[model samples]
Target: MKNKEPWYATTADGVPLVAAVPLVDAQEEEEEIPVLVVPPVTTSEVVAFAAAAETTDHPQPSAPTLEESFQQQLSLKEVPTSTTRREQKREFKREWRTMKRQAKQEWRQMKRDAKLEARALKREFRSEKRALGRNLSDVKQDLKQEKQMMKDDAKQIKWDAKSKIQEKKRELHHMKRCMRKNMLAGTFCCH
Candidate 1:
């Protein structure tokens, strides 16, 4: 037998043990879900990312603790900032125009095309797995749930952010209602 170990036995970070500190800590602490930025593409980069994230997870106790530092004596209104009103208005106009341009149907069409390309790649991989005599159904189901939760989370985030950025009281109130409902829904099923 060779001295080299099998690939399946190695960790993403090349460790023999599969360290699952983040998941374990999340279970123990009930922390609000942290933003999972896309991991870098390379295997080594992903390994490094996971390892670093695991280390960071230990230091985080809960979201309330993190929010406490920013919560005390906070003004509800955000002033136009260091920039004067006129300068802020000009910047907001520029940003709004850019945002409107990006919201156009042509941009949406391009995004749709990109999504179709990604779906095609996923289909190809599924077929390749079938040819390899591997059952990918269980893995696919887990991926489906994760994707749905991510989509809902992203939509909620976008709407919440829009309400904040526009400073719309009615929209903010409505968004809060929706968020409360979502929290209740998750409370029943989310682990």
Candidate 2:
């Protein structure tokens, strides 16, 4: 049987560990070369590597405290107490009902006032119309009386003018008869 070569290393805990491989081909059989294996990584070495990778100019963030974390969780939940929530709702409802009642009362009062005002205006307008009608009728009656008086006066003046004209005509005829009689008695006078 050929001698078997160890291809891997083991730790104390039986964990299989590997480091950087030596710069030699394992499958080649032309020449044998000494392999230089690196040691397995330890926890302190890992921590030193991490610290070396980060620069000191920048600050690292600190972990939150227990109390701060608890407060943050509580804030995220933001649950209100049931009793306080109920009281707030009750107050809101009471205010809403009060406002609604006040608005309704104001509306009713406004309607009543408007109706009263309209009725009063209607009565005033009716009274004015009736007064205007009475004044117009009185003026018409006065105008009719004046017109009748003018007609009667005109008729009386016409009758008086006709009687005067008839009296003048009768006097003229009497004078003419007297002249003729004087001429027949031989006492003729030129008129």
Candidate 3:
């Protein structure tokens, strides 16, 4: 008997090659082999198996006791819940009214301050203008007094000059009369 390979041989064109082989011979059986016959599992059995496998891999923690849950509820109840919609609306209106009043007061105060400042500035400007006018008037009076003094000085000088000229003319006339009297008495030279 010869050992045969499991796969068949193929040619270049992909056709299976047929070969001459000897046939297998059958012998009478002596002892029978035992066979294992397993039954098919149902859906419930498969689910139970999966659950048991998951639990063994990762264990879950136990739930809280009733006493612990009751204590937690009591702690939550201690905090107040006073923020209702109606209360919030009332608070918002009160704050808005206060803000409006404060803004009006501030605006009035600013206007009053501006008016007072303007009045003070106007008074200061008027005082300065009056002082300037007084100074100009004083300067004009001084100039007038100086002009009058100069005119008087000029008139006095002119009168003094005229008097000196008249005295010189009278002295010349008296000398001419004395010369005429000496010529009549024959006491003066003719040349």
Q: Model 2: number of clashes?
A: 0
Cα RMSD of predicted structure 2: 17.3
Report lDDT per candidate: 0.68, 0.81, 0.76
For candidate 2, write residues 1-191 as lDDT tens digits.
23235456778997768754546665664455456677788899899988987855677689999999999999989976547877989988999999999999999999999999999999999999999999999999989999999898888888888788788878787778778878788776454
Supply every candidate's count of residue pairs whose N, Cα or C atoms clash at under 3 angstroms: 0, 0, 0
User: Runs in model 3 with CA error above 4 Å?
Assistant: 1-86, 175-191
Instruction: Please provide TM-scores, in order, for all candidate models, with all chains considered together.
Output: 0.18, 0.47, 0.47
Which tens-of-lDDT digit does each residue in 1-191 have in candidate 1? 22222223355887544322232234444444343233225688789988998878465565566466566435444443646888879989999998898789678999999999999999999899787554467678889999999999999999999878787777667778777877878653221
Q: Encode model 3's per-residue lDDT on 15-131: one tens digit a residue.
A: 555433323321232333233333445799799999998778666788989999999999888966559999889989999999999999999999999999999999999999999
Pairs of residues at least 3 apart in sequence or in different chains that clash in candidate 2: none
After best superposition, candidate 3 residue 146: deviation in angstroms?
Answer: 1.3
lDDT of 3: 0.76
Instruction: Give the lDDT ranking, best first.
Output: 2, 3, 1
- The TM-score that candidate 1 achieves is 0.18
Instruction: Name the lDDT value of residue 97 in candidate 2.
Output: 100
